[model samples]
Target: MIEQGYNFGYLDENTKRMIRRALLKAVALPGYQVPFGSREMPLPYGWGTGGIQLTASVIGPDDTLKVIDQGADDTTNAVSIRRFFHRVTGVATTERTAEATIIQTRHRVPEATLGEHQILVYQVPMPEPLFRLEPRVAETRRMHALADYGLMHVKLYEDIARHGAVTTSYNYPVMVNQRYLMSPSPIPAFDNPKLDRMPALQLFGAGREKRLYAVPPYTPVRSLDFEDHPFVPVRADAACVICGSRASYLDELIVDDGGTRHFVCSDTDYCASRPPLQEDAA
Candidate 1:
């Protein structure tokens, strides 16, 4: 029996059906945004309502859900979402990346390699890649319909012309399946390559805008770049002080008043899973 004051999966049957239909269409046309009836979630629009809605639609009793914000599971927003799901649907919640069946993320992808069994749902504030160039919704729709991405190319080229290289660091636009241009959320460029031919199914939901999109497992995702200047993922040269991982994304923390700072893995789960630093080293 479902819990009181909440429908199964925290969403009503009718809303779930509508979202499921939209998801099916999104998966069928990979990288294409499918508009749906975005119901007003309890959470605010910019506070991961899209991801929560998507999760509510797809989650099952058998599914293990994980929620993360800026790569940390213990953050207030992440914890609230996880607890909300547990309260509503009574589904198991996990912090481990590999153990999760579905993960709702805000800014960063997990440091661990996701497998085919996992589904990643990203909370997207903006899904239209060409919106900045042309604000008109109708004009942007027409541009996408015609596969006209010249404005994006020109913008990148101008960045190269001014700065020796493309300066776009986050929310790097990607060409999915060699057709549609998709935004991979606000994840840094370092995580951009991870989206290419990844084993996990990726879904993007924009609640305020009432749109959702998908990238099927093993689909090709190439970052937009000029022929002469290729796309390069940038990261700090320093290693994480806590986990000693150089590859994982690092967060700078000021430790002392003397301006002593340390870089640590932004992924709490990733850092916790690593071997502890030696006492002698500490």
Candidate 2:
């Protein structure tokens, strides 16, 4: 049974239409952030209201939804948001990364490679990569319009001078489609490499900022870096203890007062599906 007093996906039909149109514009622009009529969601502004809106606009009855926070499916925010969509839309929900048609994520992309059929919606707190460097909105707009990103280049150069490398580990800026510089959420630099030439369509929504953007399938996304010091994706030195997978991102777990730390895969679905490391019987 559908919930009353709220339309499908908890958004009214008119608002969905407006957002759909805005989404079309966003896709067409391809990395250009487009302003939209951001409606007040039942949830708080910063708590993935933007992603929920985008999910609502795109999801259907048959679509399987997956929500994750920092690459964990069982985390509090991910659980709550998944439940919210299920209650509102009654759509099928799955924790398995491969099973979801539309995956809404915050701060990390899944370790599993997303296919062509899937769409990833990122919850963006700050859509503009230049906001930290330049506070004024009007000036930033002009800079983007003129294809000027000198400030960004200078910042990267300064980082190289101080740290001997481009030290931006997360929320690394990238040039999308060879035009716009975009923030690929707060996903670690490890995940930034997956953003390029991906089969899945990536969309970003910033509710508080009232803006949205996208990266089409197979789009070229190059992380901003200098020629001398090229971009590199850093990962934990240790492999996951349980899964024994070195490729996946890991979370450090401190075990005892002696400060014995163990590493585990941050991606729940990917870790769970992998076979246990074989032990040698001598």
Q: Where is model 2 more than 4 Å wrong at Cα?
A: 278-282
The residue-by-residue lDDT of candidate 2 on 137-254, one tens digit each, is: 9998888888799999999998988988887889999999989988897889989989999999999999989998999999999998877778889998998988899899999999
TM-score of 2: 0.96
Candidate 1 lDDT over residue span 132-242, tens digit each: 889998998888788889899999999999998989899999999988988898999999999999999999999999999999999999999977899999888888888
TM-score of each: 0.97, 0.96
Weakest ten-residue segment in model 1 by summed lDDT: 1-10
In candidate 2, how many clashes are counted? Answer: 0
Cα deviation of 235, candidate 1, in Å: 0.7
- 253: Cα error in model 2, Å: 2.0
